[model samples]
Target: MEINPAVTFKHDRSIMYAKRPKVLIVGAGLAGLTLGMLLHKADIPFEIYERAQEVKPLGSAMYFNSTTANFFKQCGIYEEFLAIGKYVSSIQVFNEVRGHEFSMDFEGQEAEFGANGYIVARPVMYDLLLRQIPRERIHLGKKVLTMDQGGNGVLLRFSDASEAEGDILVGADGAYSAVRQGLYAKLKKAKRLPSSDDLPLPFSTVCLVGQTRPLTAEEFSDIGLEQCQFRRTIGMEKMYGWATFTTAQNTVAYNVIQFLTDETSKQNDAFRNSEWGPEAAMAMCEQVKDFPIVSGDDKELTLGDLFEWSDKNHISKVMLEEKVFKTWYDCRTVLIGDACHKFSPSGGVGATNAMHDAIVLANRINGLPFHPIAEEIENAFREYKAERVEWVQKAFDSSKAFKTMTGQSFASKATRFVSKHMPAWLFQRIQAQTCANRPQVAFLPLHNDTGRIKPAPQPSLSVRAPVEAETPVAATTATATTTTTEVV
Candidate 1:
């Protein structure tokens, strides 16, 4: 009936929930589940909390980075994931103005850096990661309400009238992260992104996802679905991006998901419930339902249902433009994955970066001494946040730029120039390299551009993905002087 505060305790492995310095992972989504798996691999005791009554199939599919493949391989699920996802040779970007012309292309093995890139269904990905952990470790239907830190450690409270204590608490509950909000409230006395009144760009958009009737290899080839493909809007006016979800060589998924950015400005936080609306989110699924993408037999369609994701319908009603997001943690409590950072789905780093957070944190947990583990909570969190925030910020910046460019701003002729001149290869390579590598200054979130460097001694974290210094920093210029690979 009444809620309590968070406290710290000496976690004892003998008892499951009593483990001191125990990890409380909120939001059982990709980040939470992956973090649990990594901790499990390192023999660390952790508890994952999810507010969902059950894992719901909200979005259609997710895109995985090549680096993520390494984590998956480490988890011994690389092959299994390969089975569920669409593995493509490359990711191609095209300029729609040039008759949907090709612009950039990134190809090759992720092993050079870490993992391979793939597109997979959100639910399936969630289920796969969830399977890696024991049923007891993940507590569903538990919503985090708040967290408190004393001299010793931290205590966590849930809306379900439940309380737990640990040395470190991770807010993995996603964009509307309670732990993050609670921690930031206590630590900074200020709100974080998404949770605040920061309204996402009012530009309207539709997310259409569905299961198709499966496609033949010939049909797929005809549509140029051989490898992963992308098509940008003309003059970057309409954000149209789609990829194939091929798990096996011949097995094309009947389910294809497409994201299209528009400027129709539908009402904020409203899910268009019509089976078919002018801006139905699942229209892409409907559009391709009869496509040749098939599983095995032509009789069965890979699709089970069509769905849409609206800001209002999201588990967390936060948007990319939201300034005060889910939550923030300093010291005893911390937030990771979507719980801490929510970017435009277009960023494509949401799942990958979240998994990265879990993996990197898990690695540190495995490497730390048990005694220091409890006290060194900040150290581990620092490492995770440092690396994750920078990368996530990059992802966010990219998504926002792309959204702005393609959202059809009549006043914006800059989008036209960018589409006509900027080399698509540059973006693809930049993303691939960034996702696959980490920078030495991984801990700091602020950019050291134009004399913004910090003299802090950087540690070796295998994160030198090249984009930190190599690519253009959130700026597009005229003349296109950079000698980037001109793919189109």
Candidate 2:
């Protein structure tokens, strides 16, 4: 089949392609699934392997901020997202005794960013993204045992002894990423891995999260409201805190966090293939079940009520690890999401940053020449890191700041005071920075920016702009497709 020469489309500036490189993505979480969708839109050949036997409602809720809204529009999923999520304008904060401390209002965020942020249950968000990819491309229960890259391509060995080969490997497999472990093992053997990369992901907090079954308006008075009711309470004497967000589904998503001491954090530094199971979730739930919620009603509503209304299987417990690795890629292998930087959930930017990582990495991969050499591949990876590392650090610091604000430490108390009294201009500036890094699929038709503040410059958007050919160009290989949109 020949593609029409007159058909206008974007073209890569790099080497001409005989075929697109095949990508093997480890993990079907937000980052990997997002990259898969972008690659598919770019007509790149790729497959995703998830270690889980099935995708579960593992996380509680995710906040869709301005950074990701436009990409959702580009992917044609913005409407669906809005349908399943509750529009959030502010986060109300409270002290341990339930006294209102202050509110972090995002009142003009929509006007400034051209998109409103939403809070959606994790399962609902996951299902929405999962539907964007072809069923056959996602392989469940296929855990990566080992991985290696050569001058020609990359190879993966699964726990089942099955093998797969691809031109690129992406480690979007979360905090205890096996792909990262394997890649670091190889790098360490060659003495190329940095000393910091050898250390475990230090975590200072543990979190239990879940979404309750849909409740009647009578059950949760806030459920009847059009806007999301997001409330967080910091423990006064206890070293724990809790939050609840009402979703569009009439379900309540909640999280309870246990702030650990330095000694406790060090002692609990360990990795697990299954981050949390039913037993562990249940155990944590029992500990925080008595925690009070700011559910507006005069009748005291505690976490116990939500826990009782939630599905036992849906609850999850996870460690909140904060780190941004210095090394992101080497040879044909690269990392994204928690694999590279694991952020605390305090800022609610973990998932957003993960998807942003997907956007940048996908843009880089789409620009690669077919069967690119190690140097070319490494160059692309370097660009990806350069574009993302600084932003990731910013997000890490932001998350840490928020986490500290809710802590019981003397520093945390000072942070809380400063946060409550923070100037409006400084607050607005920080909010702008949060929305400024919105990145979209560079190989696809770009979404027009509608926000008042121009987004921070995205290098990929300009460098990887799709070009229109004046004449007929050769089609891609059978396995790889080229995505094109007709000009109106």
Candidate 3:
């Protein structure tokens, strides 16, 4: 019943693990696949297991920028994207109910800074990544149940009873990662970590996400909705209908409905004791009747409640939790994509951030040893977090600003009279930190290339010598002199 720790490091073939250090990727989604492809290009041996029996092609759009596009190019998967991606020149930011909107032109790649962003379908993107690697290396229907540390390595136990061991274990898995759960249990027991459980969530907010028919070519031309657009239906408060192109087949669409801040409205009653679905969506909508979003004009919006708030402990439930819903992480395990950081799809960055994590980590891992990865891998994670801190904060601040700028409440309407002309410096400062303005950086680890160089030997993440001395030089010195005096 007790599984021992595996301290496996990336290494050369040995008697112990002839096929050791074989990375067992838990999830087969974008992040997992990106990690796999980058490792394969570096000639690192790895295997990815997907819970699903096949590569899933559902889900709607993920906004990808030039950096992500360039990443695809770096991984030798760009042309394929161009083949499937819907390219456009700009994204129109508009009010949902009203026709008023502004457009940001996507300048040329060379003169312009940051990534040329695009909307990607989950399946198309996955299929493209799959093409770059050998099919034999990827396993389907392999569900990872739990894992534990082994001697110099980690053992992965699957539900079907299959197992795998690896030098370094990565939870490239998403936010709700099992690997994250395992690492958190170990780290929390030791208790030198910070409280990540403090992530404040939607104050009595619920999200409704569902797919409807995609846009017709005529609709695209009429709205001038080339890349992406925002439409706000203005009456009193303001709830905008956000629309984006998912796939060319015109089948994938994500319609969102969310409510916030104001909790005492009659609409809250509907969701308070509801089953959490269409009923919830309509109830949330009832509160926003003052500012109605065009449900269906160009096309009808199909909506369904995607996730709900429940406070019950995993299975032991004294009661269903309703405070806020979010997850945290640890050193051995990490939260990637939506699992680590979540956002209000009200302003669609959830999926984009997820893809960005995949690419950022891939760039860092490319051509380098992930095991003895520079302490910067931690920093890369930090930088990734840093990169997101402002971006997400800005997003949150921006979301609040969106409400405040337009005067949501009596207090906001009063505050709205104050600053119509914001300073230019603050705007420039924010623009500077963006991944679009800057390519998110990841570290490249070092390893030997025997076949490519001399026929030396296939290199690996083999464990290195013992931990270098952390003690100060003064402590190690047997004898020391304050001053050099030859006199005696």
Candidate 4:
């Protein structure tokens, strides 16, 4: 991959104006790193602070939609991303009990939207973003203790008794954000805080995620890794699981999620503090060990099969949370990504949304003049939030809806009926239309026209019926095969 000279970091202090308002970004996650990269490319002065000692594989896999792919191409890292990630050509969903199945094809999405949805391990994506940023600009292990805003800028105090000042503060510190807490305290004191910002929304599902060791040819062939197809199995007793293979590593990553719908507050509290480790993950797997993922006449993949093939230490358990705050900014301090809106993993949009937030926020700040006034910065923040709030809410609702549809309930059954019976042409049409309407980075030019901005060609909503529905299977031992083709 050819690296862009303009996108590389340059440590030329002489080019920076002394009077310019420096940006103080909290958190070194996807949102913060992306914002930092944009600031670097635009020749703006900024610094990022992270509480962690270094970047680690904290999460499992993430899916980047067409919109995010465009942003990466603009950042001049799309080729690198392609080498690390796998493009998803189709998604298959099955009702484990009923044996009803549905598959959505994404054959023409790359040409229509300029890119298809790509999936990569979270740690790999984090490292890729980190590589584009200068190490000096990122400070690790500096946990923020408090924040104070003065007439000209904001002051930050760290846990190590260190202090820093900046003209603008950005809180991309994720859901449990200290900056958000500080901003909320100030807002409440001024009687400007909304009631929704007082507490986090409760999450009821527990997820165990892990990646298996490299698979042999037979093992890989049985799992059917064609353009990295995503398979989701909706089983009995509110158990759901998803599986996909990583191209670069030749490993299969899977998530086993169980929904705790009727648990009391006491049980929830106990579960929250429960020790999560390999034992817990294996215990969860034992409960659904026999749950069928892909069943054929001679081949069957189950939860226990994948668990047995995984590295014990790599397995992790986490409770999924969902929320979208009513407030995103308070004066000079603004929140992004999970800090403002968090999504359940059902839709695989959390990281994508975070990346989008970075692009939009960077565009707004990039338009500001050097040494922008407080009022000017505030207006830019407002515009950023106003442009993003509706889309984030829509994505949040969609994720929740997907979670409901993939569960063992009346709604889930109804959704299965629709999914099983929906025509392939119709599904493709809807997907194409959705992809066509996806948002783009307003400031970045199209991939082909890197030197100038060109309006994206409006894709036609024409649908093709290339994907065929397989016959429903009644016997557990019967084989159900779906044809696979490379779309990328």
TM-score of each predicted structure versus truth: 0.65, 0.91, 0.63, 0.82
lDDT of 4 by residue, 1-488 (tens): 22121333432333544344679999999999989998888667899999878765655677876766666877889899988888887677766653647776677666666677777877788899999999999999899998987545788999988888887899999877889989999889989988878865567777778777767657756334546747777776654655544545666777777777565334545655322656766677777777776632346667787778877777777767788999898667889998889888887878878877887677667655455545556766776776677668878887887787778889978976786788878876655544443444455564452212222332111111111231222211121011001100
- Model-by-model lDDT, in order? 0.50, 0.83, 0.45, 0.70
Best candidate per lDDT, number?
Answer: 2
lDDT of 1 by residue, 206-292 (tens): 444432233455444422344443333333433333333443333222223233333223443454321234344333445543332
Better of 1 and 2 by lDDT: 2
Give the C-alpha miss distance for residue 281 in model 3, angstroms: 8.4
- Tens-place lDDT per residue, model 2, 47-136, is 999998988776788898788888999999999998998889999999867789998888887789988889999888989999999999
Off by over 4 Å in 4: 1-19, 97-100, 222-226, 264-266, 270-290, 295-297, 437-445, 448-488
The residue ranges of model 3 lying beyond 4 angstroms of the native Cα positions read 1-20, 53-56, 88-96, 101-110, 198-204, 210-241, 244-252, 260-332, 363-432, 435-488
**Best model number under TM-score:** 2
> Candidate 2, after superposition: displacement of residue 2 in Å?
34
- Ten residues in sequence with the least summed lDDT for candidate 1: 479-488
